[model samples]
Target: MDELEFRRQLYTNPRNRSEALLQEARRNNKNKKLYDDMQQLENKLEQALNVEVPDGLAERLMLRQSFDDSRQQYRRKSRWQIAIAASIAFALGLSTSLFHWQQQAADMGQLALQHVYEEMPYTSGVDEQPSLQTINAKLARYGASFEQLPGKVVYVNHCAYAGSPALHMVMKGKMGSNINVFVVPKSTELKTVQSFSDKTLHGMVEPLANASLVVVGEMKEPIEKTLHTLTAELNQAI
Candidate 1:
């Protein structure tokens, strides 16, 4: 199976022991790592959800019944305590891991690269050829619009950016290359990055008055021209 299909299947059931998935995971180290992470998260959630009654609660209640003025009240309070404890355990376990993951993606450049990788399976192909008007409509909510697109738009959607909504677009580039452009609202805490790259992709960030524009493409593909074109075409819609 392809990367996208494998990811979908694995997400459907992280503990899947299908031969196809195991083979794919064996073939690709990245896939194996992702599978492991998903499994860990699944285990944590299961452990959190598996709330068990404290030992000797029945005996303790029986003991208290002899002298307790209001047995009913005491039982209710015990139930509430147990419920609260379970909720706290679940929240602590979940939030800790999620916060750590978010911190790892705190860098604007790293976040952009990570987003590109996640969406590449879908965005690499020409799934949709949206009009400039359609693209601008999506951008309008982000306080920006395009007068003329830099290139042919193949895919466009709104995706998460640091827990906020951001515009994601895939445009056709020179020599059959695909370029990813992200428009994120300006944030006080997250400063814009000049540029960033990995083994497979490289990109630059352009900070605007109302938003930061990130342009990403393959390692060797020339993205500076596309960046300039987009910078010129972008008009403040607010």
Candidate 2:
């Protein structure tokens, strides 16, 4: 298959392990790389979409609805008493089930990896290295500012992350590799983790007082060093 046809088939169904497509990919290094990248993206997308609902989510929702009904029927009860019960129920639901749901929905590492692949079609020709001032222009929206980056920047853009605006950046890594860094406001639903990884990439999440930094790099890249440098150099507006 030609490049266009190969890409078409690969994206349409990355799991198509037919011999014909496999042979085509094996014959062309570029096609093989593209095939692997698309498959990894598909896997991550599947993982993000297939999260199991908490064991008692429906029961909690029912309980919440029941609480609402009770409030309507017990008008004579002290307002504070009814309110307290409702609050307790809501908190219990969130603490047990909704919180897990949120964590799955806002899996920052998976989201970041997906974003990188989604932008792959456009990132190749990106040649501009944004200045620090230019980069901070976007970061300012999240109450964040970077004192300096650990390496040369290759790309920068604004993106939506976990239902909030985020600043996405790509920097140069060892041997001309690409490392992605995302600056997201603390207000966003995404809670940062210490580290995360997928088939082709791995990185760390640094949670600041008012914002979070998610740094992603190829599996072979020195991501920990970059994260250390970034945590030390990154400044947040208190």
Candidate 3:
């Protein structure tokens, strides 16, 4: 048969005479290659025909593919949702921690203020006679000189320091400066002196009149200078 008629018969009646014709073509040199190619194509066609398609297999495959796509989309959306939830939880935790810290800070500030107020002296009756000379003499013993600043001394009292009463005084100074002086009784335990700076003001603690004296002021000169001058002058007069 001609090539076109052979190919037509091969496809039209692939079972009958096609196998016998292919075996004869394989024996010929030029038809050998064609026979092999046609055998391969025929085998592929047999495989395609023998493949038993399940009922609604195409529809089931399409449904499975759609399900896989939906599953992938859900997974991606779930990841985003989890990430968003974690972010919200983290934000809430941070806010809660910050709020707690602020509350603690406020409570600490109040406690500090309360402590300061507790240590402060209270004023009562005005009937008690004011003994300015006797007060000055006691302060002088503690290396503190009693100098009348421009304003009257509204507050004068003795505070306990290391079992001894230390003379404490508050007086108004020039340019709205409030002068505070404390004379501690002399003790070996109060030898070490320290100074601290708070904002613009500098304060010092040192041995004066046998006790630890802490003076706070904004004066340009060193605190030691003021302490030394006051102590020397007071000691000499006493």
Candidate 4:
């Protein structure tokens, strides 16, 4: 047989013509080498393709052809079943991962808000009436160097900022406006300004030399003026 017919016989049905050809070649001494070379080439091709020429596979194919029945129905059914099962498993895994991510995000948000509320100065009892001298003295240690702006210093205490001890003072401004100042020594004053507002009060921040000053009050204009004057005084002291 020609090369194409020989290959087709080996792939389509190896049991029938392949063995018969080998037996015929062995009977004919002239074709014995050709038959041995063909067998070796076929073995090499099978190894390269990683396909085992099962003895039963060719028998089953011939039997099915003779019976005229569909032989690949079971394989097609198995493939479809495996595909559907894989899709369902992937969807379930994806949903579980998304749910876990969302839960972690919500927990992180609550933790962040709680930490921020704890660090805020307005939430503490620092506004209660305290000794003014003690407060000013503590502020002086943090480089406040105050000249006592015309007001009754009613509240004085040290507050924590970013794990460092800072000064917090509440002095009665003109017209019953309370001036709350926060001083941090290690932080350098920058030109940036920011505002914060709670339900009951509003506050502004300003930079001072080697420190940051924040004043929380109800009126904006008076607080701004006080912050500007305090910033100038604190800068001169440094």
The 10 consecutive residues of candidate 3 with the worst lDDT sum are 107-116
lDDT of 2: 0.74
Report the C-alpha lDDT of model 1 over 188-214, residue by residue, as the tens digit: 656467999999999999988789999
Best by TM-score: 1
Q: Please write out the lDDT profile of model 2 over residues 11-128, one tens digit for every residue.
A: 6678998888898899878888988999889889888756544543443333333344465554433343455555676578768897766767577777788777766665655657
In order, candidate lDDTs are 0.82, 0.74, 0.50, 0.54
What is the clash count for each candidate, in the order shown?
Answer: 0, 0, 5, 0
The residue-by-residue lDDT of candidate 3 on 1-238, one tens digit each, is: 4443344345444554556567656556765665566668888977864643343333322323334457678556555555555556668987999886555433322222232233333322112233567567666656555454323354556654433456655444344444455655655433344665544455566654345656555555355665565555443222
Model 4, 1-238: lDDT tens digits are: 5332343344334444456666555665655665566668777877865633443343333222333336587555445555555556668987999876555433322222232344344434334455545555676666656555424566656654433566666666655756666775543322234666555456676656666677766543366677676766552355
Give the candidate order by descending TM-score: 1, 2, 4, 3
lDDT sort, best first: 1, 2, 4, 3
Best by lDDT: 1
Misplaced by over 4 Å in model 3 are 1-131, 140-152, 199-201, 218-229, 236-238
Instruction: Say which prediction, candidate 1 or candidate 3, comes out ahead on TM-score.
Output: 1
Using Cα atoms with residue i matched to residue i, what is each candidate's TM-score against the true structure?
0.62, 0.55, 0.35, 0.40
Which RMSD does model 4 reach against the true structure? Answer: 32.5
Off by over 4 Å in 1: 1-44, 48-99
